[model samples]
Target: MDAIVALHQRVSQSRLTAPAPDSIQLDLLMRSAARAADHGNLQPWRFLIIEGEGLIRLGQLFARVAAAKKPDITQAELDRFTAMPLRAPMIIVAIAKCQPHPKVPEIEQVIAAGAATQNILTASFALGLGAIWRSGEMAYDDTVRQAMGLSNNESLKEQILGFIYIGTPDADARPARQINPKDFFSTWTGE
Candidate 1:
Protein backbone atom coordinates (compact mmCIF):
# COMPACT_ATOMS: atom_id res chain seq x y z
CA MET A 1 0.00 0.00 0.00
CA ASP A 2 1.10 3.49 -0.71
CA ALA A 3 2.50 5.40 2.26
CA ILE A 4 0.15 8.33 1.76
CA VAL A 5 -2.87 6.08 1.57
CA ALA A 6 -1.81 4.24 4.72
CA LEU A 7 -1.20 7.51 6.54
CA HIS A 8 -4.52 9.01 5.45
CA GLN A 9 -6.77 6.02 6.04
CA ARG A 10 -5.26 4.24 9.03
CA VAL A 11 -7.83 3.70 11.79
CA SER A 12 -7.70 1.92 15.11
CA GLN A 13 -9.10 -1.60 15.06
CA SER A 14 -10.43 -2.17 18.54
CA ARG A 15 -12.15 -5.49 17.85
CA LEU A 16 -9.37 -7.67 16.59
CA THR A 17 -9.38 -11.41 16.02
CA ALA A 18 -6.85 -14.22 15.75
CA PRO A 19 -4.33 -14.81 12.97
CA ALA A 20 -2.05 -12.03 14.03
CA PRO A 21 0.58 -10.60 11.69
CA ASP A 22 2.89 -13.35 10.49
CA SER A 23 6.65 -13.32 10.86
CA ILE A 24 7.29 -11.46 7.62
CA GLN A 25 4.66 -8.87 8.41
CA LEU A 26 6.11 -8.50 11.90
CA ASP A 27 9.56 -7.97 10.45
CA LEU A 28 8.25 -5.16 8.28
CA LEU A 29 6.47 -3.55 11.17
CA MET A 30 9.58 -3.69 13.34
CA ARG A 31 11.65 -2.23 10.56
CA SER A 32 9.20 0.59 10.18
CA ALA A 33 9.28 1.21 13.91
CA ALA A 34 13.06 1.38 13.92
CA ARG A 35 12.93 4.12 11.31
CA ALA A 36 11.28 6.55 13.68
CA ALA A 37 13.16 9.84 13.98
CA ASP A 38 15.37 10.36 17.01
CA HIS A 39 17.41 13.25 18.31
CA GLY A 40 21.07 12.74 19.18
CA ASN A 41 20.68 9.26 17.69
CA LEU A 42 19.55 8.07 21.10
CA GLN A 43 17.29 5.20 20.16
CA PRO A 44 15.65 4.90 23.56
CA TRP A 45 12.99 2.36 22.72
CA ARG A 46 12.44 -1.36 23.10
CA PHE A 47 9.56 -3.81 22.67
CA LEU A 48 8.45 -7.02 24.33
CA ILE A 49 6.35 -9.41 22.27
CA ILE A 50 3.67 -11.17 24.29
CA GLU A 51 1.41 -13.98 23.15
CA GLY A 52 0.26 -17.47 24.02
CA GLU A 53 1.06 -18.25 27.67
CA GLY A 54 2.81 -14.94 27.95
CA LEU A 55 -0.52 -13.22 27.46
CA ILE A 56 -2.03 -15.34 30.20
CA ARG A 57 0.75 -14.39 32.59
CA LEU A 58 0.34 -10.73 31.70
CA GLY A 59 -3.36 -10.91 32.43
CA GLN A 60 -2.65 -12.61 35.74
CA LEU A 61 -0.20 -9.88 36.62
CA PHE A 62 -2.81 -7.23 35.89
CA ALA A 63 -5.30 -9.03 38.04
CA ARG A 64 -2.80 -9.35 40.84
CA VAL A 65 -2.09 -5.65 40.74
CA ALA A 66 -5.78 -4.75 40.81
CA ALA A 67 -6.49 -7.19 43.64
CA ALA A 68 -3.62 -5.82 45.65
CA LYS A 69 -4.92 -2.28 45.34
CA LYS A 70 -8.57 -2.90 46.17
CA PRO A 71 -8.28 -6.18 48.10
CA ASP A 72 -12.04 -6.40 47.68
CA ILE A 73 -12.37 -6.16 43.93
CA THR A 74 -15.23 -8.29 42.68
CA GLN A 75 -14.71 -11.36 40.54
CA ALA A 76 -15.99 -9.44 37.54
CA GLU A 77 -13.49 -6.68 38.11
CA LEU A 78 -10.68 -9.19 38.34
CA ASP A 79 -11.89 -10.91 35.20
CA ARG A 80 -12.02 -7.62 33.34
CA PHE A 81 -8.45 -6.79 34.27
CA THR A 82 -7.30 -10.30 33.45
CA ALA A 83 -9.04 -10.41 30.10
CA MET A 84 -7.43 -7.25 28.78
CA PRO A 85 -4.45 -9.04 27.25
CA LEU A 86 -6.75 -11.60 25.68
CA ARG A 87 -8.34 -8.86 23.60
CA ALA A 88 -5.74 -9.44 20.89
CA PRO A 89 -3.80 -12.47 19.70
CA MET A 90 -0.61 -10.52 20.01
CA ILE A 91 0.60 -7.50 21.94
CA ILE A 92 3.83 -5.58 21.74
CA VAL A 93 4.66 -3.69 24.87
CA ALA A 94 6.35 -0.49 23.76
CA ILE A 95 8.80 0.77 26.36
CA ALA A 96 10.95 3.84 26.45
CA LYS A 97 14.48 2.95 27.53
CA CYS A 98 15.19 6.49 28.46
CA GLN A 99 18.54 7.21 30.10
CA PRO A 100 20.24 10.33 31.31
CA HIS A 101 21.55 12.31 28.37
CA PRO A 102 23.06 15.74 28.54
CA LYS A 103 22.09 16.47 24.94
CA VAL A 104 18.68 14.83 24.96
CA PRO A 105 15.89 15.12 27.52
CA GLU A 106 13.70 12.30 28.78
CA ILE A 107 10.60 13.80 27.14
CA GLU A 108 12.26 13.64 23.72
CA GLN A 109 13.09 9.98 24.29
CA VAL A 110 9.50 9.25 25.21
CA ILE A 111 8.22 11.06 22.12
CA ALA A 112 10.59 9.08 19.92
CA ALA A 113 9.30 5.84 21.40
CA GLY A 114 5.75 7.03 20.71
CA ALA A 115 6.70 7.78 17.13
CA ALA A 116 8.03 4.23 16.82
CA THR A 117 4.69 2.91 18.04
CA GLN A 118 2.89 5.10 15.47
CA ASN A 119 5.08 3.63 12.77
CA ILE A 120 3.98 0.14 13.80
CA LEU A 121 0.31 1.19 13.69
CA THR A 122 0.64 2.69 10.21
CA ALA A 123 2.60 -0.26 8.93
CA SER A 124 0.01 -2.66 10.31
CA PHE A 125 -2.72 -0.82 8.42
CA ALA A 126 -0.72 -1.01 5.20
CA LEU A 127 -0.19 -4.74 5.69
CA GLY A 128 -3.90 -5.44 6.05
CA LEU A 129 -3.48 -6.07 9.76
CA GLY A 130 -5.50 -4.49 12.57
CA ALA A 131 -3.79 -2.59 15.36
CA ILE A 132 -4.70 -0.43 18.32
CA TRP A 133 -2.65 1.57 20.81
CA ARG A 134 -3.95 0.98 24.32
CA SER A 135 -2.67 2.25 27.67
CA GLY A 136 -4.33 3.20 30.92
CA GLU A 137 -3.95 2.72 34.68
CA MET A 138 -2.30 -0.66 34.31
CA ALA A 139 0.31 0.90 32.09
CA TYR A 140 1.36 3.36 34.79
CA ASP A 141 0.97 1.08 37.77
CA ASP A 142 4.33 0.48 39.41
CA THR A 143 3.40 -3.05 40.32
CA VAL A 144 2.51 -3.83 36.74
CA ARG A 145 5.77 -2.33 35.58
CA GLN A 146 7.68 -4.44 38.06
CA ALA A 147 5.91 -7.54 36.84
CA MET A 148 7.05 -6.67 33.35
CA GLY A 149 10.60 -6.64 34.81
CA LEU A 150 10.98 -2.90 34.52
CA SER A 151 13.21 -1.10 36.99
CA ASN A 152 11.54 -0.28 40.30
CA ASN A 153 11.47 3.39 41.20
CA GLU A 154 9.21 6.37 41.69
CA SER A 155 11.13 8.45 39.14
CA LEU A 156 12.28 5.82 36.64
CA LYS A 157 13.08 7.23 33.25
CA GLU A 158 12.13 4.03 31.50
CA GLN A 159 8.37 3.59 31.23
CA ILE A 160 5.71 1.81 29.26
CA LEU A 161 4.54 3.77 26.26
CA GLY A 162 1.67 1.46 25.28
CA PHE A 163 0.50 -2.06 24.68
CA ILE A 164 0.01 -2.34 20.95
CA TYR A 165 -2.50 -4.97 20.00
CA ILE A 166 -2.20 -6.39 16.49
CA GLY A 167 -4.36 -8.96 14.76
CA THR A 168 -7.01 -9.38 12.07
CA PRO A 169 -9.92 -7.02 12.46
CA ASP A 170 -13.07 -8.84 13.53
CA ALA A 171 -15.00 -6.34 11.42
CA ASP A 172 -14.18 -3.61 9.01
CA ALA A 173 -12.68 -0.55 10.65
CA ARG A 174 -14.51 2.74 10.45
CA PRO A 175 -13.62 5.06 7.62
CA ALA A 176 -11.06 7.69 8.36
CA ARG A 177 -12.46 11.16 8.88
CA GLN A 178 -10.67 13.81 6.94
CA ILE A 179 -10.04 17.03 8.76
CA ASN A 180 -8.84 20.13 6.97
CA PRO A 181 -5.21 20.99 7.61
CA LYS A 182 -6.19 24.64 7.35
CA ASP A 183 -8.18 24.23 10.55
CA PHE A 184 -5.05 23.24 12.45
CA PHE A 185 -2.42 25.21 10.55
CA SER A 186 -1.65 28.94 10.55
CA THR A 187 1.06 31.31 9.53
CA TRP A 188 3.12 32.49 12.46
CA THR A 189 4.25 36.09 12.42
CA GLY A 190 6.74 37.53 14.88
CA GLU A 191 4.91 40.54 16.24
Candidate 2:
Protein backbone atom coordinates (compact mmCIF):
# COMPACT_ATOMS: atom_id res chain seq x y z
CA MET A 1 0.00 0.00 0.00
CA ASP A 2 1.16 3.54 -0.68
CA ALA A 3 2.42 5.40 2.37
CA ILE A 4 0.15 8.39 1.79
CA VAL A 5 -2.92 6.24 1.44
CA ALA A 6 -2.11 4.34 4.60
CA LEU A 7 -1.46 7.57 6.46
CA HIS A 8 -4.78 9.05 5.40
CA GLN A 9 -6.88 5.91 5.87
CA ARG A 10 -5.41 4.40 9.01
CA VAL A 11 -7.96 3.67 11.71
CA SER A 12 -7.64 1.94 15.06
CA GLN A 13 -9.08 -1.55 15.20
CA SER A 14 -10.52 -2.20 18.64
CA ARG A 15 -11.68 -5.77 18.11
CA LEU A 16 -8.55 -7.64 17.13
CA THR A 17 -7.97 -11.40 17.06
CA ALA A 18 -5.05 -13.84 17.11
CA PRO A 19 -2.30 -14.26 14.52
CA ALA A 20 -0.12 -11.31 15.30
CA PRO A 21 2.23 -9.66 12.87
CA ASP A 22 4.93 -12.00 11.58
CA SER A 23 8.63 -11.22 11.82
CA ILE A 24 8.75 -9.46 8.46
CA GLN A 25 5.82 -7.21 9.32
CA LEU A 26 7.33 -6.44 12.69
CA ASP A 27 10.61 -5.50 11.04
CA LEU A 28 8.76 -2.97 8.91
CA LEU A 29 7.04 -1.53 11.96
CA MET A 30 10.29 -1.27 13.88
CA ARG A 31 12.03 0.37 10.95
CA SER A 32 9.18 2.85 10.63
CA ALA A 33 9.40 3.66 14.35
CA ALA A 34 13.16 4.22 14.14
CA ARG A 35 12.66 7.09 11.73
CA ALA A 36 10.68 9.30 14.11
CA ALA A 37 12.05 12.82 14.38
CA ASP A 38 14.34 13.33 17.36
CA HIS A 39 15.80 16.54 18.60
CA GLY A 40 19.51 16.71 19.48
CA ASN A 41 19.85 13.28 17.88
CA LEU A 42 18.80 11.84 21.24
CA GLN A 43 16.72 8.79 20.52
CA PRO A 44 14.83 8.84 23.78
CA TRP A 45 12.53 5.91 23.22
CA ARG A 46 12.53 2.14 23.64
CA PHE A 47 9.98 -0.64 23.20
CA LEU A 48 9.28 -3.85 25.08
CA ILE A 49 7.80 -6.55 22.89
CA ILE A 50 5.28 -8.67 24.80
CA GLU A 51 3.83 -11.88 23.39
CA GLY A 52 2.91 -15.41 24.45
CA GLU A 53 3.74 -15.75 28.14
CA GLY A 54 4.81 -12.14 28.32
CA LEU A 55 1.20 -11.06 27.86
CA ILE A 56 0.24 -13.29 30.78
CA ARG A 57 2.90 -11.62 32.92
CA LEU A 58 1.68 -8.18 31.90
CA GLY A 59 -1.91 -9.12 32.75
CA GLN A 60 -0.87 -10.45 36.13
CA LEU A 61 0.96 -7.25 36.82
CA PHE A 62 -2.18 -5.27 35.98
CA ALA A 63 -4.34 -7.33 38.31
CA ARG A 64 -1.78 -7.10 41.08
CA VAL A 65 -1.65 -3.38 40.73
CA ALA A 66 -5.43 -3.18 40.91
CA ALA A 67 -5.59 -5.44 43.98
CA ALA A 68 -2.86 -3.47 45.67
CA LYS A 69 -4.97 -0.33 45.38
CA LYS A 70 -8.11 -1.98 46.75
CA PRO A 71 -7.58 -4.89 49.08
CA ASP A 72 -11.21 -5.94 48.77
CA ILE A 73 -11.18 -6.07 44.97
CA THR A 74 -13.35 -8.95 43.75
CA GLN A 75 -12.33 -11.85 41.55
CA ALA A 76 -14.47 -10.50 38.74
CA GLU A 77 -12.60 -7.23 38.87
CA LEU A 78 -9.29 -9.06 39.03
CA ASP A 79 -10.29 -11.22 36.11
CA ARG A 80 -11.24 -8.20 34.10
CA PHE A 81 -7.88 -6.64 34.73
CA THR A 82 -6.16 -9.87 33.79
CA ALA A 83 -8.06 -10.00 30.53
CA MET A 84 -6.93 -6.53 29.46
CA PRO A 85 -3.72 -7.71 27.89
CA LEU A 86 -5.45 -10.64 26.29
CA ARG A 87 -7.40 -8.24 24.11
CA ALA A 88 -4.56 -8.39 21.63
CA PRO A 89 -2.35 -11.19 20.36
CA MET A 90 0.74 -9.07 20.97
CA ILE A 91 1.65 -5.79 22.66
CA ILE A 92 4.48 -3.37 22.20
CA VAL A 93 5.04 -1.19 25.26
CA ALA A 94 6.41 2.11 24.11
CA ILE A 95 8.65 3.75 26.71
CA ALA A 96 10.07 7.21 26.67
CA LYS A 97 13.62 6.96 27.97
CA CYS A 98 14.25 10.65 28.39
CA GLN A 99 17.76 11.89 28.86
CA PRO A 100 19.19 15.25 29.85
CA HIS A 101 19.88 17.32 26.79
CA PRO A 102 20.75 21.00 26.68
CA LYS A 103 18.60 21.66 23.62
CA VAL A 104 15.81 19.15 24.10
CA PRO A 105 13.39 19.38 26.99
CA GLU A 106 11.86 16.27 28.55
CA ILE A 107 8.50 16.92 26.86
CA GLU A 108 10.16 16.94 23.45
CA GLN A 109 11.68 13.58 24.20
CA VAL A 110 8.28 12.23 25.11
CA ILE A 111 6.82 13.61 21.89
CA ALA A 112 9.53 11.81 19.94
CA ALA A 113 8.41 8.57 21.52
CA GLY A 114 4.79 9.39 20.67
CA ALA A 115 5.75 10.00 17.04
CA ALA A 116 7.39 6.58 16.95
CA THR A 117 4.17 5.07 18.29
CA GLN A 118 2.16 6.79 15.53
CA ASN A 119 4.51 5.24 13.00
CA ILE A 120 3.91 1.81 14.49
CA LEU A 121 0.14 2.19 14.15
CA THR A 122 0.34 3.47 10.58
CA ALA A 123 2.76 0.73 9.56
CA SER A 124 0.45 -1.89 11.04
CA PHE A 125 -2.38 -0.66 8.82
CA ALA A 126 -0.10 -0.71 5.80
CA LEU A 127 0.64 -4.38 6.52
CA GLY A 128 -3.08 -5.27 6.60
CA LEU A 129 -2.87 -5.90 10.35
CA GLY A 130 -4.90 -4.29 13.10
CA ALA A 131 -3.36 -2.16 15.84
CA ILE A 132 -4.38 0.26 18.55
CA TRP A 133 -2.52 2.48 21.00
CA ARG A 134 -3.82 2.44 24.53
CA SER A 135 -2.71 3.60 27.96
CA GLY A 136 -4.85 3.89 31.02
CA GLU A 137 -4.20 4.47 34.72
CA MET A 138 -2.27 1.19 35.05
CA ALA A 139 0.16 2.35 32.42
CA TYR A 140 1.40 5.19 34.64
CA ASP A 141 1.26 3.40 37.97
CA ASP A 142 4.56 3.20 39.84
CA THR A 143 4.15 -0.50 40.53
CA VAL A 144 3.48 -1.18 36.86
CA ARG A 145 6.59 0.72 35.92
CA GLN A 146 8.57 -1.20 38.53
CA ALA A 147 7.23 -4.48 37.19
CA MET A 148 8.56 -3.50 33.77
CA GLY A 149 12.05 -3.12 35.34
CA LEU A 150 11.75 0.64 35.49
CA SER A 151 12.22 2.79 38.56
CA ASN A 152 9.74 5.43 39.76
CA ASN A 153 12.56 7.90 40.02
CA GLU A 154 12.05 11.31 38.43
CA SER A 155 14.47 10.57 35.64
CA LEU A 156 12.41 7.75 34.18
CA LYS A 157 9.62 10.10 32.92
CA GLU A 158 7.31 7.43 34.37
CA GLN A 159 5.15 7.41 31.27
CA ILE A 160 4.14 4.30 29.33
CA LEU A 161 3.63 6.22 26.10
CA GLY A 162 1.45 3.44 24.79
CA PHE A 163 0.75 -0.27 24.85
CA ILE A 164 0.30 -0.87 21.16
CA TYR A 165 -2.05 -3.85 20.80
CA ILE A 166 -1.43 -5.70 17.55
CA GLY A 167 -3.31 -8.55 15.87
CA THR A 168 -5.38 -9.54 12.87
CA PRO A 169 -8.55 -7.58 12.43
CA ASP A 170 -11.67 -9.54 13.34
CA ALA A 171 -13.69 -7.37 10.96
CA ASP A 172 -13.11 -4.59 8.50
CA ALA A 173 -11.49 -1.59 10.20
CA ARG A 174 -13.84 1.34 10.62
CA PRO A 175 -13.62 3.87 7.84
CA ALA A 176 -11.66 7.01 8.51
CA ARG A 177 -13.69 10.02 9.65
CA GLN A 178 -13.79 12.72 7.06
CA ILE A 179 -12.02 15.82 8.29
CA ASN A 180 -11.18 18.82 6.17
CA PRO A 181 -7.58 19.93 6.60
CA LYS A 182 -8.56 23.47 5.71
CA ASP A 183 -10.69 23.68 8.83
CA PHE A 184 -7.77 22.53 10.98
CA PHE A 185 -4.85 24.41 9.42
CA SER A 186 -4.06 27.70 7.72
CA THR A 187 -1.11 29.90 6.87
CA TRP A 188 -0.31 32.64 9.36
CA THR A 189 0.17 36.19 8.16
CA GLY A 190 0.44 39.45 10.03
CA GLU A 191 -2.64 41.44 9.11
Candidate 3:
Protein backbone atom coordinates (compact mmCIF):
# COMPACT_ATOMS: atom_id res chain seq x y z
CA MET A 1 0.00 0.00 0.00
CA ASP A 2 1.02 3.61 -0.54
CA ALA A 3 2.35 5.52 2.45
CA ILE A 4 -0.64 7.84 2.74
CA VAL A 5 -3.25 5.09 2.51
CA ALA A 6 -1.28 2.90 4.89
CA LEU A 7 -1.05 5.71 7.38
CA HIS A 8 -4.78 6.26 7.22
CA GLN A 9 -5.43 2.56 7.72
CA ARG A 10 -3.05 2.52 10.64
CA VAL A 11 -4.77 5.44 12.30
CA SER A 12 -8.10 3.70 11.93
CA GLN A 13 -6.73 0.39 13.31
CA SER A 14 -5.58 1.73 16.65
CA ARG A 15 -7.13 -1.12 18.62
CA LEU A 16 -5.76 -3.93 20.76
CA THR A 17 -5.97 -7.70 20.22
CA ALA A 18 -4.67 -11.05 21.56
CA PRO A 19 -2.64 -12.47 18.71
CA ALA A 20 1.06 -11.53 18.86
CA PRO A 21 3.30 -9.99 16.22
CA ASP A 22 5.98 -12.37 14.98
CA SER A 23 9.66 -11.78 15.68
CA ILE A 24 10.46 -10.96 12.05
CA GLN A 25 7.59 -8.53 11.76
CA LEU A 26 8.56 -6.90 15.02
CA ASP A 27 12.16 -6.45 13.87
CA LEU A 28 10.94 -4.83 10.70
CA LEU A 29 8.63 -2.60 12.68
CA MET A 30 11.46 -1.58 15.00
CA ARG A 31 13.59 -0.67 12.04
CA SER A 32 10.84 1.60 10.85
CA ALA A 33 10.52 3.01 14.34
CA ALA A 34 14.20 3.83 14.48
CA ARG A 35 13.92 5.81 11.29
CA ALA A 36 11.88 8.50 13.00
CA ALA A 37 13.35 12.01 13.09
CA ASP A 38 15.57 12.77 16.03
CA HIS A 39 16.92 16.20 16.84
CA GLY A 40 20.63 16.33 17.67
CA ASN A 41 20.76 12.67 16.59
CA LEU A 42 20.21 11.77 20.20
CA GLN A 43 17.77 8.97 19.39
CA PRO A 44 16.55 9.21 22.95
CA TRP A 45 14.14 6.30 22.82
CA ARG A 46 14.19 2.62 23.65
CA PHE A 47 11.78 -0.28 23.43
CA LEU A 48 11.28 -3.32 25.60
CA ILE A 49 9.58 -6.08 23.70
CA ILE A 50 7.35 -8.12 25.99
CA GLU A 51 5.87 -11.44 24.96
CA GLY A 52 5.01 -14.93 26.24
CA GLU A 53 6.08 -15.20 29.87
CA GLY A 54 6.85 -11.49 30.01
CA LEU A 55 3.18 -10.72 29.59
CA ILE A 56 2.40 -12.95 32.56
CA ARG A 57 4.93 -11.04 34.64
CA LEU A 58 3.40 -7.72 33.56
CA GLY A 59 -0.05 -8.99 34.47
CA GLN A 60 1.16 -9.88 37.94
CA LEU A 61 2.66 -6.43 38.31
CA PHE A 62 -0.54 -4.80 37.10
CA ALA A 63 -2.56 -6.76 39.62
CA ARG A 64 -0.23 -5.78 42.42
CA VAL A 65 -0.32 -2.12 41.48
CA ALA A 66 -4.09 -2.11 41.12
CA ALA A 67 -4.61 -3.84 44.45
CA ALA A 68 -2.21 -1.50 46.24
CA LYS A 69 -3.90 1.57 44.79
CA LYS A 70 -7.42 0.39 45.61
CA PRO A 71 -7.63 -1.89 48.58
CA ASP A 72 -11.40 -2.08 48.30
CA ILE A 73 -11.24 -3.54 44.82
CA THR A 74 -12.67 -7.05 44.54
CA GLN A 75 -10.78 -10.12 43.43
CA ALA A 76 -12.73 -10.00 40.17
CA GLU A 77 -11.48 -6.52 39.47
CA LEU A 78 -7.94 -7.47 40.28
CA ASP A 79 -8.23 -10.44 38.01
CA ARG A 80 -9.48 -8.19 35.25
CA PHE A 81 -6.46 -5.96 35.66
CA THR A 82 -4.16 -8.98 35.66
CA ALA A 83 -5.78 -10.23 32.49
CA MET A 84 -5.08 -7.03 30.59
CA PRO A 85 -1.72 -8.23 29.25
CA LEU A 86 -3.38 -11.28 27.79
CA ARG A 87 -5.34 -9.10 25.39
CA ALA A 88 -2.31 -8.99 23.11
CA PRO A 89 0.36 -11.53 22.21
CA MET A 90 3.09 -8.92 22.35
CA ILE A 91 3.63 -5.42 23.69
CA ILE A 92 6.31 -2.88 22.85
CA VAL A 93 7.11 -0.68 25.82
CA ALA A 94 8.32 2.64 24.46
CA ILE A 95 10.68 4.33 26.90
CA ALA A 96 11.83 7.91 26.60
CA LYS A 97 15.37 8.84 27.66
CA CYS A 98 15.49 12.49 28.60
CA GLN A 99 19.20 12.99 29.09
CA PRO A 100 20.21 16.64 28.78
CA HIS A 101 21.61 17.65 25.41
CA PRO A 102 23.46 20.83 24.63
CA LYS A 103 21.36 21.86 21.64
CA VAL A 104 18.22 19.79 21.99
CA PRO A 105 15.42 20.38 24.49
CA GLU A 106 13.80 17.56 26.48
CA ILE A 107 10.56 18.07 24.61
CA GLU A 108 12.33 17.35 21.34
CA GLN A 109 13.50 13.98 22.65
CA VAL A 110 9.98 13.23 23.79
CA ILE A 111 8.59 14.14 20.40
CA ALA A 112 11.13 11.85 18.76
CA ALA A 113 9.97 8.99 20.94
CA GLY A 114 6.41 9.76 20.02
CA ALA A 115 7.38 9.64 16.36
CA ALA A 116 9.06 6.28 16.84
CA THR A 117 5.87 4.96 18.41
CA GLN A 118 3.87 6.19 15.45
CA ASN A 119 6.32 4.47 13.11
CA ILE A 120 5.90 1.18 14.91
CA LEU A 121 2.14 1.60 14.82
CA THR A 122 2.04 2.47 11.11
CA ALA A 123 4.33 -0.43 10.22
CA SER A 124 2.15 -2.84 12.18
CA PHE A 125 -0.99 -1.71 10.42
CA ALA A 126 0.65 -1.94 7.00
CA LEU A 127 1.67 -5.48 7.88
CA GLY A 128 -1.97 -6.41 8.62
CA LEU A 129 -1.62 -6.44 12.39
CA GLY A 130 -3.84 -4.87 15.00
CA ALA A 131 -2.14 -2.38 17.32
CA ILE A 132 -2.85 0.08 20.09
CA TRP A 133 -0.83 2.49 22.21
CA ARG A 134 -1.82 2.59 25.89
CA SER A 135 -0.32 4.17 28.99
CA GLY A 136 -1.59 5.53 32.31
CA GLU A 137 -1.16 4.55 35.95
CA MET A 138 0.47 1.23 35.22
CA ALA A 139 3.10 2.86 33.09
CA TYR A 140 3.77 5.46 35.76
CA ASP A 141 4.09 3.14 38.76
CA ASP A 142 7.43 3.00 40.51
CA THR A 143 7.31 -0.75 40.92
CA VAL A 144 6.41 -1.23 37.29
CA ARG A 145 9.25 1.06 36.18
CA GLN A 146 11.67 -0.87 38.37
CA ALA A 147 10.49 -4.14 36.88
CA MET A 148 11.27 -2.73 33.45
CA GLY A 149 14.82 -1.82 34.60
CA LEU A 150 14.19 1.91 34.67
CA SER A 151 15.25 4.27 37.45
CA ASN A 152 13.96 7.78 37.95
CA ASN A 153 13.83 10.79 40.23
CA GLU A 154 11.02 11.14 42.75
CA SER A 155 9.14 13.69 40.67
CA LEU A 156 9.56 12.03 37.27
CA LYS A 157 8.31 8.55 36.38
CA GLU A 158 10.81 8.14 33.48
CA GLN A 159 8.02 8.54 30.93
CA ILE A 160 6.83 5.22 29.45
CA LEU A 161 5.61 7.10 26.38
CA GLY A 162 3.46 4.16 25.26
CA PHE A 163 2.70 0.45 25.31
CA ILE A 164 2.27 -0.79 21.76
CA TYR A 165 0.15 -3.92 21.74
CA ILE A 166 0.24 -6.03 18.56
CA GLY A 167 -1.76 -8.98 17.35
CA THR A 168 -3.91 -10.49 14.60
CA PRO A 169 -7.47 -9.32 14.39
CA ASP A 170 -9.87 -11.63 16.18
CA ALA A 171 -13.03 -9.63 15.51
CA ASP A 172 -14.54 -7.36 12.91
CA ALA A 173 -12.77 -4.10 12.17
CA ARG A 174 -13.77 -1.13 14.24
CA PRO A 175 -15.81 1.84 13.02
CA ALA A 176 -14.27 4.04 10.38
CA ARG A 177 -12.99 7.45 11.44
CA GLN A 178 -14.44 10.64 9.99
CA ILE A 179 -11.68 13.07 9.10
CA ASN A 180 -12.55 16.75 8.68
CA PRO A 181 -9.43 18.63 7.68
CA LYS A 182 -11.21 21.99 7.67
CA ASP A 183 -11.90 21.78 11.36
CA PHE A 184 -8.19 21.26 12.08
CA PHE A 185 -6.68 23.55 9.46
CA SER A 186 -5.40 27.08 10.00
CA THR A 187 -4.42 30.09 7.90
CA TRP A 188 -1.53 32.53 8.36
CA THR A 189 -3.51 35.60 7.22
CA GLY A 190 -2.65 38.39 9.66
CA GLU A 191 -6.11 39.34 10.78
Q: What is the TM-score of each candidate against the true structure?
A: 0.96, 0.95, 0.90
Q: What is the C-alpha lDDT profile of model 2 across 1-191, one tens digit per residue?
A: 99999999999998999999999999999999999998887878889999999999889999999999999999999999999999999999999888767789999999999999999999999999999999999878888887887644655554688799999999998899999999989998988
lDDT (CA) per prediction: 0.92, 0.90, 0.82
- Using lDDT as the measure, name the better of candidate 1 and candidate 2: 1
The best candidate by TM-score is: 1
lDDT digits (tens) for residues 33-128 of candidate 3: 899999888887899999899999899999998998898999999999898888788888999877767798889888999999999888887888
Where model 1 places Cα greater than 4 Å from the true spot, the runs are: 152-156
- Window of ten residues with lowest summed lDDT in model 1: 149-158
Give the candidate order by descending lDDT: 1, 2, 3
Better of 2 and 3 by TM-score: 2
Q: Which residue pairs clash within candidate 3?
A: 19-167
Write the residue-wise lDDT of candidate 1 on 51-124 in tens digits.
89999999999999999999889999999999999999999999998877889988999999999999999999
C-alpha positional error of residue 66 in candidate 3 after TM-score superposition, expressed in Å: 1.3
Tell me the lDDT of candidate 1. 0.92
* Prediction RMSDs, each to the true structure: 1.7, 1.4, 2.5
